[model samples]
Target: MRTLIIIPAYNEEGSIAQVIGDIREHAPEVDIVVVNDGSKDRTEAIARDAGAEVITMPFNVGIGGGMQTGYLYAYQNGYDAAVQMDADGQHRAADLPKLLAAIPYSDLVIGSRYVEQTAYRSSATRRVGILFFSKLVSFVTRQRFTDTTSGFRAANRKVIALYANYYPSDYPEVESIVYLKRRGCRLAEVPVEMRSREAGRSSITPLKSVYYMLKVTLSVLMSASRVRVRGVKTSG
Candidate 1:
């Protein structure tokens, strides 16, 4: 199947080239697209020079908007599947094949850091939030998810079309799991190891993480409460 690797970058000039290079070295067959989310740095130029198609947004629209743009591109261009990855070097390129391999049996496949009990450790505060959301999502979806906030994910054509039309604009990864569960989309997880960021600081501070937890929890609850209507159509 034709797959597009969507790398959403925001001021990732320090790491974009290396990330793109890794993807090329590891998953050379899959097409790559870097959605530059209004970065103030030279991220776009670096990605373009590295031979990945670059899509620049007018302003910083967050990860959700950047990913939606990629889904739309994939949908329109007839890609059978698309993978959402980070340009910060946290997500390993070697795991792309595992994600793609799982796509045949599931509508969505997530690269989970905690699935096999790896050495990947987060801050205490972040781990608490991850555990909370993992339980909450498991309860709501009736399926256990070890990593609810993992951005390393792959989606098939149906999901790509669905997300292109109606993706959450903020804190989307967690909320998106609930959304897909509501629609009866099959989900799967694979064990993958992630590295610490090679460059650039995370946007989520300690205080912001608290607010993120509260807001995303509320969003997931609201999403779960909605009734699933049948016959929803999406452009292929």
Candidate 2:
């Protein structure tokens, strides 16, 4: 498959080059595109220097908007599949093949940290939120998700087109799974090891994490209600 790795970056000048280099070293065959989400830093310049195609947003549109731009690029360029990875170096490039291998079985494949158990750890509050969302998503979609917030994922052309047309704007990862399920897209998860951020602090603080959980839960519930009422299955 013609796969494109989409890295959404915002003020990631510290780690963007290393992330791009790792992807190039590990997955040379696949194309790479870095969506610079209106970074005040030199993220776009560094990404360009790293030899990956760069798309600079005029303003910060958050992760979802940046990823949607990548999907649109993939769709317009006729890519058969696309994989999303972080620019902070948390996601491993070596795991790209595992995600791609699973693409033949499903429309979307998520790289999950809890699938086989590794050394991934988060705060207790965050863990509780993840557990709550996991069960809630399973209940709504009838598909269990071990890690709903994981940004490491691969998608087929159908999913690419869907996301290109419409995607959540903020805190989109968990809600996106539910959206795909509602649209009748097949989803699966594979075990992958995630490393700690090599540079920069996470944007999610304790207060933001609380808000994230509440907002995502509400968004998922609202989307599920609409799907049930419409009784419509979205097509590629």
Task: Write down the lDDT of every candidate, Cα atoms only.
Answer: 0.91, 0.90
Candidate 2 lDDT, 85-190, residue by residue in tens: 9998999999998899999999999999999978888777778888898899989998889899899999999899989988899999988898888888899999
- Which runs in model 2 stand beyond 4 Å of their true positions? 198-200, 228-236
| Per-candidate alpha-carbon RMSD to the true structure | 2.3, 2.0
Query: Candidate 1's residue-wise lDDT over 153-218, tens digit each?
Result: 999998998899889998899999999888878899999999965333777877787789889999
| Candidate 2 lDDT (Cα, 0 to 1) | 0.90
In terms of TM-score, the best-performing candidate is: 1
Candidate with maximal lDDT: 1
What TM-score do all the candidates reach, one by one?
0.96, 0.94
Candidate 1 TM-score over all chains jointly: 0.96
lDDT for position 215 in model 2: 93
How does residue 198 of candidate 1 score in lDDT? Answer: 36
